[model samples]
Target: MTDAVLKIENLQTYYGKSHILHGVSMEVAEGEIVTLLGRNGAGKTTTLRSLSGLTPPREGRIEIFGNDTTRWPAYRIARLGVGYVPEGRRIFPNLTVLENLAVPMTRPGPWTVDKVLELFPNLGTRRDSWGRQLSGGEQEMLAIARALLVNPKLLLLDEPSQGLAPLLVREVFRVVASMREQGISILLVEQNARFGLEVADRVYVLNDGQMIHSGPARELAKDEERVRALAGVGGKEDGVLTAKPKTSAA
Candidate 1:
């Protein structure tokens, strides 16, 4: 664990009156693409939120780059070399592309507007356009680029492939895959098992807010029965499975 970039030990989280995660613990090693794979509402987003301290786990601990920041505020956690690109591509709808990309800059060593545009030329072409003006794919690219501009050591990505066409999904995943090549560690939460497993070095599957499966991405991809049964992707529907996500320890 000496080289672990992010660590969660028996973490528990809550949402007002509801409990969500249940003794959940995981780790992201430095410069690796590790994904949390789950069905919709399997506490994937909440896990990312807890890691980023947006919703701090009520129990257990969160460590970023070996520093304990369990009680830190979201901004403080963000300042600890962690950047999160949330689900739904939560960019500022009213801001221009340039404005959105610049909103999260702290000291900025490498990720500049010109540089991000160079990486994503389509976004460069729409630099002056409003956030809402871009398509879903374009907005996702913009959101990710904005996070990278801060030179974050660990990136928490929630459902980066959601709601995009196959072509755009490929485009975004390629960008994510490239982040590892650039030596940026990633903790990705994704529902697209196929693509998630394809790029991930390691993966964890969450079911009913519990860690039911853990293995190399390739192994999980090959287990058809497990993929269909516990994953909620194939076979008879399980009535116990619900879409309302809660925060708890898993």
Candidate 2:
């Protein structure tokens, strides 16, 4: 990959006595979107956590913006222009929309309170509303908006489309696509394989803590059977990933 904003090599991580990720590796090029697809407990979230420094890898190399950050703390990693939007839309329920947006430790960049509000106008209308009062879509939007305030070069999004209506999912993806145009590389963990394949430039599939396939999103999206097989989406697991050009080891 050219101009890679983030790269992980032979990553191995664990939780207490349980080994989770097994030599999983992937990269996100500058201004590109790379989606991580897998069934529940495929070590998808663990990968993001490791990259964000919330859970330092047991072994591996993590380079962000060409810096060796394998042992950096979570706050230090955030300072390197990496914005992470974790699963569950972790917002300050007691804070207003405006307050929640203002909470992130910001950096010097184009993403500001007003700019993100403009990008997510639904949030703008409810600026005075408490986060707890917002709908699920609104909460998700708020979460994304809060992360953008960090003015990151790379964004890590975990399940941004989970538990939302079909139309809302499209809206979330549309916003995500727009971020690429603004030059923010994204590493997205998405449960909805179809949406992940549709919006991402490249795709990585993980099964049982191992990478099964990596290729162009368009290439994999062409075969519905292959998508379901590699990702286990819709619960129909079949077929193995054959040799494909540009495949990144998971």
Candidate 3:
């Protein structure tokens, strides 16, 4: 991997009085896809929040594009070319799809509303549809498209495959994989360990708010015993990793 596009060291975050992440540390290299995997409540989402400055870490160092942005405000971080698509697809419920796309005051880059619409033709066809009218998969697509309009060099995605059908999961992963070719680095938090491993160049496994494993995704994918110990055993139905997360801040 090239020099890191995003890096963190000793990241500690909290939710009011509850400490969620304990010295979590990781990185996403330039143009590489890195997946952060763990069972529910493993502080995966909190990690993304810390990186995006949504929930700034209580203690840590965060470097994006070589600038130390650990305590920068969220808007300042976004302007530095970091796009974050949070856990829920938080589009404006009453707005039209086209209206939603027009919301971001993006940095100058190759991604435009028309360009993203061309990438997601289904959305293009439903340009005038209200956000609440779209299906779950469509909403997910819209969220990702809107993130792209920020012209991000690094994208932080949280649980993108959640609540979608199997086919849609595959399609979403396909699009995510293509982003690397377009010179975008990704830090992906996914519960679908199967698809997460499939697309990632490298992997980071979180357990109890700490990083337990970090290595090439292929190495982790081929070792089922290690995967079981680190991320829990895989389900027989869809091969998803299922572990009982500790009762802590998720």
Q: Best lDDT goes to which candidate?
A: 2
Superposed Cα RMSD, model 1: 4.8
- In candidate 3, what are the lDDT values of residues 58-157, reduced to their tens digit? 9989999999999999989999998888887897889999999998878999999999999999999999999999998899999999999999999999
Worst 10 residues of 1 by lDDT: 235-244
RMSD of each: 4.8, 6.2, 3.1
Which stretches of model 2 miss by more than 4 angstroms? Answer: 234-250
Choose the strongest candidate by TM-score.
3
Q: By lDDT, rank the candidates, best first.
A: 2, 3, 1
Provide TM-scores for the models.
0.91, 0.92, 0.93
lDDT of 2 by residue, 1-250 (tens): 6699999999999998799999999999999999999877899999999999999899999999999999999989999999999988998999999999989899999989999999899999999999999998999999999999999999999988877777888899999999999899999997777778889999999988889999999888788888777876731222112211123234
Worst 10 residues of 2 by lDDT: 236-245
- Model 1 bad stretches (over 4 Å): 234-250
Greater lDDT among 1 and 2 belongs to 2
How many backbone clashes does every candidate have? 12, 1, 0
